[model samples]
Target: MTLHAIRDCIHAKKVWDLCVPKRWRKHFFLTQDVKEWVRKNITIKGRLEDFEWRQWFPIICHNIWLAHNDRVFQGSLPSHQDTLVQSRACLAWSSLVLHVSNTVAMPCWEPPDEGKVKFNVDGSLDVTQNLRGCSGLARNHESMVLCGFLYRMPSGSILSTEIWSILWALKVAWDRGFRNLEIEGDCVVAVNVVIEGVGEEHPDLCVVQEAQMMLKQDWRVNLLV
Candidate 1:
């Protein structure tokens, strides 16, 4: 089966299993009711249900319930066909929440040796031609010593330059064998895109992908923008 099909199958099974628990159903309805009350009064998205309801109901029922109630709590109340879509969305949201929680909870790595290495990156763009330049600076926290500076002129759009700056900074950290490294950048968009793996509309996503691979290596790198 194709990757999409396989993933769908897994999500289906997960949603089904999640529905088997009686507690989940209770939580779903209770949360849904609470969310409805909130939406009528408050403007928050409200709390998400702790269970997956997507695989339990039919598509029409699912959509109708979602239209009338909060999707997370009311999602399982629908008919079968709609379950797959709802389940997949739930799974994706769950994964994102878990990832963000883990990322936030991760403690800063204590360097095996003394001193901390801070890497700062910045990008400049010429609005007229859309030409860009990226620069990165690495320094030691204790000594305030400038470890190195990386500069690159990326061809094409301004996005390419911002992305290249991050790639170069990561490369420098890997090469230097630094265990604890913090990266600082002024380009919030590039930093967030890299961290979240959300590539832009630009054609040069290959660079971003390559940088992501390098960043998955064994080291602690924090992005500060």
Candidate 2:
């Protein structure tokens, strides 16, 4: 039933006829084995108009299956044109996502400004094992390690762990007499809470307030995710 909807249905045939080239149709339609048919369609690379056949092929099959369901269950018949248009839309969206993923640059670590120390902190949790820990390190402008610490927690929520890590890192830096400092943590919630103070009723208000106090003290400290 599934195979019939994707490959042998009327709408599926129409899409294949419009996309598959004349020279390829013989081998393409002759593959009766499901695995072999799918393998050939994806690996035998070619293009249909402006779309790559590998990407467009599965999209067309998916849309065809959707139309089949709509017609069968909802009693709404879909034209071949609608299925083709939907397939094209899916292909365009997938292409845009792929392009963005390939072209966009990933975030990289940057050293602190001259005369300032950078503290990078991160927390980890293993829910199944009920384990949590956090580690932080401070580096000077020239990238030399100034101070660092690793502490394990008996039990705590993720947010509390992140907040505690920030608090600990700040305390460590201040104790080492680094007044000009920049703090970086992968946890956005913790950094944002410290920058933009939380309300009184917030769940993690205690730790957040403690972290806020450390930031508000007489020193220059910048925080970011």
Candidate 3:
């Protein structure tokens, strides 16, 4: 039983016991079929409060396989303590790389689900020229442009332009009876302010509040940053 030797053996079992949460251990170790077990553990969603099972699954399996190889070929293998340290190091490095890739990558545009429209908006500012504006378009699931708006502001912060764009887009959509919308913008601050609400002392409080109020109307709006 290669799977048993790699996973259920004394040394490997000790490592898994320390790494996997007790509450999830039953479901984690339930499957005995090799393919099903591998698929189940690797693709399992959600995580422990402080741990990530998705990353841990492969790391633990690789370490155990390495130890099994060492015992068979070299007649020597590191103690469970050494194996645990190596697994931790690998886990930390893997998590760091995952974080960096997620942060640096720009995801491709995905069409909205059926029966919904996606509104993509962006704001631009030229501080040197004292110019700012915002533009947005609504697209159907087929990527057909349904409606759009463009506005130029003589003077205002970039955040103001972004918030204004959202407000106007929502108003137009609501007027046209567009109830299901997924709004996207590159300005993280503006999106967060509208979705999470802003403080009274915030500079763009009024406009952000207006946008928030529109979102709370009898409509379904999703804000994506």
Clashes of each: 10, 0, 0
Give the clashing residue pairs of candidate 2, or none.
none
Return the top candidate by lDDT: 2
Question: Given candidate 3, what's the lDDT at residue 137?
Answer: 70
lDDT of 1 by residue, 86-151 (tens): 343334323434665777773342322355687766666677865566666555755332333334
For candidate 1, list the clashing residue pairs, or say none: 54-83, 57-78, 57-79, 57-80, 58-78, 58-79, 58-80, 59-82, 61-78, 62-78
User: In model 3, where do residues sit more than 4 Å from their true spots?
Assistant: 1-107
Q: Give the TM-score of candidate 3.
A: 0.51
Q: What is the C-alpha lDDT profile of model 3 across 76-146, one tens digit per residue?
A: 87677656555654554345346657879856679999999888777767787677777677778997555
TM-score of each: 0.45, 0.51, 0.51
Clashes of 1: 10
lDDT of 2 by residue, 75-145 (tens): 97566765675566455534544665798864656999899999877776779878887767677888755
Regions more than 4 Å wrong, model 2:
1-106, 201-203
All candidates: CA RMSD (Å)? 20.1, 21.4, 20.1
Q: Relative to the true structure, how large is the alpha-carbon lDDT of every model?
A: 0.53, 0.76, 0.75
